[model samples]
Target: MTRTFRRGGTGGAGGDLDLYQYAYLAGGGLRVAESAVVSLTERGTLSLGAARLRVTGEERPEHPVELAVVVACPRSKPVREVIESVGHSSEVDVIARRLVSLGLVRRWRRKPTRAGRRRLADAASAGQVPAYALRGPAALVPGSARRGPLDVHPALGDLGRALTRMGKALDDDRGHGTDSSADAGGFGGGGGDW
Candidate 1:
């Protein structure tokens, strides 16, 4: 099984908040393995099965540069640029730290992958804002983020109607003599009444 890690940021004070999503694939298909929100300030190690990792985060001198370094990312880039790729830098750092703590991700001397870089590019292009990306003050609970369910997804609408009809039928069946009397009536009127 393979897993994916990701981060997102929010605006204002506390920097970015980090979050991760893990996907597990088996003979059936793909499914969500695990997901969580993490904090940026911490040092720890993680061990997932045979894999082991260590990570650390500390504030740096260069504003954006420091943030990137704390996340063990090489080179300097704007906060917006970082946010674009991984989400908020702070959030990403927190997630990285969490990975360290959880044993999912660790700090070590290793080269980045083309797939990882591509994932960053996709994150950037998606324009996934920070508010909904992280937890605590920054992250917005997905379901509560908007007013309510859209009820406009076509299939969902149909399902809603079907459920409504089913409910009405259930109510009718559960009622007293009214349903039985109604059923007894034939064509234009009841047999004896006609």
Candidate 2:
């Protein structure tokens, strides 16, 4: 479905996203690489060797991630190297751009847009996401992105706490605010803070 994105870039919810998009949602490009490995292994097109992944079948890859993995495994490369190669390949960029265009992922960063989160939730509920592909820190965090600057920058939460500390340190903790005339050392006075 066609989606029109708002200027702030949290994006609007439209419909379900694909498995690769879901992988991107959970763990960026690395997760996509892991997923391609699992798919290839399950299909018997790829076999794992001693510290390597060897192609056993002549099956042509159809997906970008799959193609990247297959192309990198021409001679049974190390498993780690193969995954890393595909993780950093142009194919991941292509997947990322498609997600960005669909409003499922933000540009530049690997963060899923708000609508993208909904798409992930949809996939989860439908059991479209393979359980083996998601776990640990890379797993999807439930709920919408935090509000305000925190939504745009996860690190901004720390800045917000710092601002609170500044307010408390000024004895403005009582909500006396800038008009308290308590003298904020000229750093936080004049209603500069919200």
**lDDT of every model, 2 decimals:** 0.28, 0.61
Residue 181 in model 1: shift from native, Å?
76
Task: Give a tens-digit lDDT track for model 2, residues 79-184.
Answer: 6678678988898888788888888888877688887787776666656677534531112222211122333434434323332332232223234434536564
Q: Model 1 — TM-score against the truth?
A: 0.18
Candidate 1, after superposition: displacement of residue 171 in Å? 54
Model 2 quality (TM-score): 0.60
Q: What is the lDDT of residue 37 in candidate 1?
A: 12
- Span of ten consecutive residues with least summed lDDT in model 1: 24-33
